[model samples]
Target: MGMPASPAHDTVDPGEGLMKKQIRTTLILTLDDATMSSFVPLLQKGVQVKAQLGRSMKHLLCEQYGVNPEYLTERIQTIFLDGKVVDNVETTTVKGGAIIALSAAMPGLAGATLRTGGLLAAFRDGLTHEEDLEAVDSHELGMVTVKLFNLLVRELGPVLLEKGVWVTREDAESLVKRWADTPLRAIDHVEMDGLKVSLEELAGLDWSGDSEYLLLRAVG
Candidate 1:
C-alpha cells in the first residue's frame, strides 16, 4: 500500500538499487522422516496455493490440480469452502482468496453430517454451501487457502509441502524456530531459489510484502 503506483514495486527495490529485488524468498528444505512429521502442523494451520479461481472445487482439484478422481471420492471424504460445508463440489465455485479445507472421514455423528453428500447431509442444510448466482463467472489467477486435517494432513500434506506453499516469512521463521527447540530430525539441506543457504540466512532474508508471502517447500 505504501509503494509507488507503478510496475517498479512489483519487481524492483529502488532503495537498494539492485537488479534482483527481494520481493519474496523461495525456501526449499530437504527433510527426512522425522523432519517431515514435524511439518504436518504448519500444513494443518493452512497455506496458500495459487490457482485459477471462479471454478468448481471438482474442477480445481480433479482437473487443474490433477488429483485422482477415485482418491478424491474415497480418501478426501469431507470438503469445506470458505468455512461452509460442501455437498456438491462440481457446483460450488472457489472465489479469489477462498479457503478450502479437506479431510478424511471424521469419526462419529458430526463427521457423518459433514461428509460430502453424506446420508445425514440434510441435517446441516443451514451450513451447506450454496452457489452464488450473483458472483462473476470468469476464471482468474489468485491464491486459495488450503487446510488438511487428520489423515489428510499426513497423507496429502507432503505433496503440497513439496510442491511449495505461500506463507508469511514470519510464520515460516517461527516454524523453523519451533523446530529448533524440539528437534525431530536433522535438516538435510536449505535452499533459496535453488541455491544453498544457511538456515539462519533463510530466516533473516528480506522477504517483502505488507503480509510478506514467501514460498516454502519441503522434500523428503
Candidate 2:
C-alpha cells in the first residue's frame, strides 16, 4: 500500500499523511490517570491504524472495531474522511492512505453545516465526501490515519492507544518536551518491545533519520 511518511524531512506536515513502509519500533507505556491525560490530546493530531482499504466508515467502526452504532451516531457529530467533510458514512469507502477524523459537534454554524446528514448539509454542496464511482474494491492491507477531537479524544483515544497506534517523529519530539515538564519517572510503567525503558532513553532517541514511527501502546 502507498503511504507517505510524515515529517522527518523538510517537506511533510505534522499530521495527515501515511507512514513510510516501516520499522516495528513499538514503545508501550502505562501511566497514571493524570499522566495519561497528556497523551489523549495526541489523537487530535492523528494516529495510524492498519485496515482493509475498501470498508465503509460505518463498517470500519461498528463491524471491524466493534464501536457501538448508537454511540457512533449519537456521540460522533462530525466526520472527515481524508480532509473532506462527510455527510454519509455508509456509502463512503475509506481508501488506502486515507485519514478519518472524528469529533463531537463543533461550536456554531460550522457544526450545523458540517455534521453528517445534518439539516444544513445542502449548504456544504460539493464539500461533502462522495464515493468513488470507478474505484476498484480491494481487500488490501494498508495504514489509515484516525484523528479524534474534542470529547472523542477522551472517549476514543484510549481504545486506539490500547490497540497501539503509530505516531510520527514530530510527535516523538513533542513527547520529549512533555516528559521534560512531567518526568517519565512519573509514568506508571513503560516498555520498548517487551523491555522496560525510561523516558530519558526515549527522549534521547536519535530522531534524525527516516525510521519515522513510534508505535505507542497505552496500558493503564
Candidate 3:
C-alpha cells in the first residue's frame, strides 16, 4: 500500500503558488476618521486588482470618494517584499506587490519634528499651499519627510549637485524665500534615484499633531 499522505501534502492547494504570486500591497492611508470608514472596503478592492490597484484607488477615492489623490497618497506608505537589506533603505517595495500603512500628518508638531530630523532640506526647495497641509496629520507627515530626505541625500544628493540641481548657498536661500508663500508636496521617484521633495515641502505645511506612522505593512 502507498504510504499515508502527509498532512501537509493533502492540505497543500495549487492556488497557494498563485496566492503567493499575488501582489501584496500595504496602503498607508491618511484621512480623517470619517474618511477611513469609507476607505476600508476600497482598500480591500485595491489589493484584489493588484496592478490596477492604484488606478482603482484613484477612481474610487479621487473620483467617487471625492478625495485628493496626492493628499491621500502622501499619507500612505506601502511596504512590500523585495531583495536584500540596508540601513538606509527603511522601506522595501516589490514589483506587483505593495504593503500599505496609513497615518495623518497635518502640520505643527510633526513639522517641527521633521525639521529637527533634517528632513526640512526639501521643503527649503519649494512651497505648496495651506489647504493641502490641512489634509494630513503631523507625525505621519514628518516621517515621510525624513524618509524622503534621507533617500535623496543618500542616492541623488551627489548627482543633483553634479547636475546643478543645487550647488550654491544662493539656491538654498531662494528655496527658503519661497517657503513663505506656500507648502510644497515632495515627490518620491522609485526608479529615478528615489529623490523625494514633497515631504520637505509639507514639512512646514501643517501644524496639527494628530497622526500615526504605519511602520510595517505585512511580512511574509
Candidate 4:
C-alpha cells in the first residue's frame, strides 16, 4: 500500500536552507550600551567605508548607506570633507579615499562658525570645502574614510559597523583586548583573511605596524 501523503510543512525545499544562511550572514549587528562604549573611540577616529564612486555626499549617506535624509539635513549640523567644512553636501562629490566627518550641533561661537550655512559661515570661508570640478576616473568600488563625533558616534556608529568598516589589524587587536576586561561580551565572531578567529587568538597576535586594514563587523 502507498504511504499517506506527508504534511506540507514536512517537505524541505533545498533552496530554503541556503536562503536562511545568507540572511543570517548578512544580519545587522545589535549595539547595546557596552558595545557602543567599546567601539566609540574607533568610530570617532575614522573607519574605512566601501561605496560607489561619483556619488554626492548626500546621496552616499542618505541613499547608498540608508541614513535618514531628514536626519542628515536636520541633526547633522556639521560636516567635514577632507578636513574642510562642507556647506553643500549635494554638490560635494565622494571620491575614493576621501574623508568625511560628521558631528551634531556644537555650542559656542566656534561651533556657529563651523556649521554649514550658519550666519557666521563667512568667518570660516577659508576653511570651507569647495567641490572639485575636475573629472576623476570612476570605478565600481570606492573607499571612503568616515569619522563620527559626539552624539553621531553613538547614534550612527552601530549602523556603519554593521554595514562593515575597514580597520587596522592593530586597532582590531587593541579593541578586542580592551573588551577582554569588560564584563559585557558582544563579539559574535571574528574573522581575519576570511578565517574565523577566537577572541583569545586575536588578542595574542602581534599585528604588523604598517597599515593593514581588515573588514570588521560586530554581530550580537
Candidate 5:
C-alpha cells in the first residue's frame, strides 16, 4: 500500500493576515463613562503632547500639564521612561519623542520592586533609568508621547484627551477603523481637520500619510 500522504502544511491566509496586521496597528481610545471601564484595560496607545524638550519630567507634568505636584508624588506610584522604571521624576529629563508611561500601584513582587521609591526599589536598581545632567537646546514645539496605564488611564486619560492630544493622521485613521463597528454611541461625533464626519466616512477616507498631525479630543 502507498505511504500515507504527508500532513498538509499550515499556512496563513493572505486576507486573514492582512486583517490581523491592520488590527494590530489600530487603536481605540474612549472617554465615555460607559466605555471608560472597558477601554481602560485596552488603552495601550500613546498620546502626543507638544512640549519644550530637555525639561525635567516633573516640570512637564506639574508646570506644563498642570498636574498637581502632590498628586504626582502621592498618587502616581509607578513611572517608566522608555521602558525602564524611573525613580526621580523631578530630575529625569523628558526629551522630544520620548515615551513616558505612568501608572498607579500595582500588585505582586515585580510591581513592588519597580515602583518609585518603594521598599523593594533597591531590587530594581540595575534596571532603573538614570538621567543625564547635560543640557540640550529645547525645541519650541516638540512632541512627546505619553501613555497612561491602569488607574492612570481612568484618572489622567480624560483630562489629557479633553485638553487635546496630537496624533498622526495614520494613527487617527487606524483608530477610526478599529471603532467603526463597535456600538460607539458615546462618541459625540468624529472630526477630521476640524470638519465633522460620520463614522463610516471617517473610516473610508484615505489619510494623508505625511507628517500632519490631528488634535484629538474626546467630547462627552
Candidate 6:
C-alpha cells in the first residue's frame, strides 16, 4: 500500500498495537513427582469449575453490562517460574516442582467485573455494577485455589486408586477452606441447595454445550 491522500502520515506504535491485540497468555508450570501426580485430578476439577463460571460471567458482563465478553483486551495474565510472566508460549513446558502465576483482564469494567460474585452468588442477586470489585478480585483468585485443590485431588485419586496417597476430598476441602483467608488461594466455596462446589468449577463450566468453550476459567 502506498501513502497517497495526505503528505504527512501519523506515527504508529507497533508495540502498543501488539499489546492491545494480544488476548491470551501462558506460563511454564513445574510440579514435582508428588506434586504433579497429586494435582491432576484437582486440575481437572478446576477446569470443570472454570467451564461453569465462564458462561455466567460472560453473559452477565456482555448482555447486562454491555461489555464484550470475547474482547482480546480482557485477557488473563499468567506468570511462570518464580512469579514472573512467561516470555514465550511455544517453548514453555509444565514439569515437576513448578510455579505458575496467571491473570486475566476484566476489560473496561475492571472494577465491576472484579466485584461480581461467582455462580452461587448469581442465585442471590447476580453481578451488580454497584458491587465492590474487590469481591470479584477475591472470586477470580479463587480459581487458582480450586486449581491447586483439584490438582491435589486428582493426584490423590490415582494413588487412592492405584497405590494410595491417603488423600481424600476432605483433605482437599481442608486445604481450600484454609486458603479462604490468605491472598493466594482465598475464595470461599459456593454452596447451592446443599451441593457445594469450588470457584474453578464455577469458572470453567460449559452450560452452552458448544465446542471450543472459553479457556480462561479452565486454564486459570
**Which is the leading candidate under lDDT?**
1
Order by TM-score, highest first: 2, 1, 4, 5, 6, 3
Worst 10-residue stretch by lDDT in candidate 5? 1-10
| Candidate 3 RMSD computed on C-alpha atoms after optimal superposition onto the true structure | 24.0
157-201: candidate 6 lDDT, tens digit per residue? 222222112223333433334434434432222321123344343
Q: How do all models score by TM-score?
A: 0.81, 0.81, 0.18, 0.78, 0.74, 0.21
| Candidate 4's TM-score | 0.78
**In candidate 6, how many Å is residue 104 off?**
1.1
lDDT of 4 at 144: 90
Q: Candidate 2's residue-wise lDDT over 42-150, tens digit each? A: 7888889888778788988788766789998998999998778887888888888898999998999988999988999889968788778765558787899999999
lDDT of 5 by residue, 1-220 (tens): 0112222333333332232222121222333566444435334587787777988888888888778889999988898888888888777888878888898888999888988878887788577887786856464568888888877887786666655677777666766776677876665444444334456655666665445676665534
For TM-score, candidate 4 versus 6, the one ahead is: 4
Worst 10 residues of 4 by lDDT: 19-28
Error of 2 at 36 (Å): 2.0
Candidate 3 C-alpha lDDT tens digits along 1-220: 0111112111222322322231122111121223223223223222211122222323422443234555434532221112111111112212233332222333564443333113442453332111222222211101111111222222222221111111122222233234334343221111101111222332232222222211111100
TM-score winner between candidates 1 and 3: 1
RMSD of candidate 1 to true structure, Å? 8.4
Off by over 4 Å in 6: 1-74, 106-220
lDDT value for model 4: 0.72
Please give me the total number of clashing residue pairs in predicted model 5.
0
